[model samples]
Target: MRLSEFSVPDTLAARGALALAEQYQSEAITAHALRSWVWAEAFALVDGITGIDHELLYVAAVLHDIGTVTEFDNHTLSYEHAGGHVAIALAAGAGWESERRERALEVIVRHNWPRVDPAIDAEGYLLEIATGLDISGARPDALPREFVRDVLDAYPRGALAAEFGACVVDQAERKPDTAARRLVDGGVLEKLAANPLEAR
Candidate 1:
């Protein structure tokens, strides 16, 4: 999973989804989403996890945060659920079959709640772990240091803590009892402040 060779899907659905994501999200959020794909792919290689559809994960990674953006934000459900629907719709419009589209939705939704079982859904599990690594700075030792450095070089995580904190605070206001609220109440800011990546 070399960052040098990493590329977003070139298909219409992928392009459209990315365009929407870039339109709605701040630069930091968009960069974070792109970095998620790089981190997930690198992690997969480290764990020797194979059979992944990189293209599908690319789609999932880019649109996973649509719920956090203004246009798609839903007050009732968590951002993950809201964004999952948007991802599914994007996949549907791209002519993805039901099973594949549903899998993309599952990956987006599962990313919010950590620890998706790899056996059940490897892509979802990888996305979950990848986002966790980016957001919470969890498990710094999970991947090789050189790979992490290379990724940061390619996609510098500029002010990710502040960006993610703001997003979570918004979610806390829109929907309580969700993961965002837990993260806010659980001192995620302090955690973000303590992120080792920020030290770089």
Candidate 2:
């Protein structure tokens, strides 16, 4: 399915999450978050992934990179875990039950790790794939031609590559013992301008 077939969640929690992201993050980050959601939905359609709670997935997608924002940055743990806590707080404020909030937290934290298992946690897996596809140039061939054109037309990669690369590199430099540092050390953001999954 195309991105046009999907709709963002309209709940207060969803709206607040987006608003909070916009309030704290740069334009590039906000755009990347939205694009990640579209990519997740696109992959789910193409790969036949199922049994997802779209609203919860929406929350996870939008807030996945929140730790990159200055306000959420925690020096001790990886940014993934820090952002997961921020998401959990938002979920709690929204009156999410204990179980649902925990699951959402799991999805948020898992996005930082590689090799997500869809069978065990579909939202996390899809979010991980989608974020990787958008930020690291992973699996561009999985997207349909028309779909790629449509998503870029809507979100516009613009300066996201440069912006995101800087964010990752900065995090790695500031927080030495974190996953972002590992990704940087491994050259994940070395090709700054070349990594984003643009339409061919």
Candidate 3:
């Protein structure tokens, strides 16, 4: 399988987000974040999607699941909203301008949306496709089969299905109006478990 061609952003924002995710997120979550970035980048290339801000996508991808972390997780906010807020503060600390910081917030929050308008936010569209693919194995044809396997080999799923599912389940129970609740009501846990990626 000797797959070593993959790489990720090393810019200040990318590096800062990576560090933040490492420090606050669990092993499964950190892996999910990394995989999300890889998948997002792949989608950009394969789909010929352009006008992407690599740093922004990298930052959003790495921190998309931030709210699932204990430090950022809260009782009132949906994880996506909490994660968006966390990204805003973290991006500010990383010296991102107000507009860029707000964009990051939008990208993070919109990643959980049913669909993102690519014309409006390329980063959000990519993140949604990538995260949806990574966590639930939706739209399996978006990427080549071998490439998917290689990416999985490099970043194993470990307990992501269990850990992330539990987090959403918690969110559903506490914040019934959020997307997390809808996902739970829709049997997200079972979907995660049955995700074809698990067999990769």
TM-score of each: 0.93, 0.94, 0.94
lDDT of 3 by residue, 1-200 (tens): 12355567667777888889989988889999999988888888877898889888888999998997788888888888888888888788889899999998899999989899888889999999999888778888878888888888888999999999988888888889999988888878988999999877
TM-score of 1: 0.93
Clashing pairs in 3: none
Question: Which pairs of residues clash in candidate 2, taking residues 3 or more apart in a chain or in different chains?
Answer: none
Candidates, ranked, lDDT: 3, 2, 1
Give per-model CA RMSD.
Answer: 1.6, 1.5, 1.8
Our model 3 lands, by Cα RMSD against the true structure, at 1.8
Off by over 4 Å in 1: none
User: Candidate 2: where is the Cα deviation over 4 Å?
Assistant: 196-200
> Which lDDT tens digits does candidate 1 get at residues 1-200?
45776667789778977888888988788888888988888778877889998778988998888788888988788898888888889889989899998888889988977478888888998899898888878888887777778888877888778888888898997788888887788788887888787776
Candidate 1, after superposition: displacement of residue 58 in Å? 0.9
For model 2, where is the 10-residue window of minimal lDDT?
A: 191-200
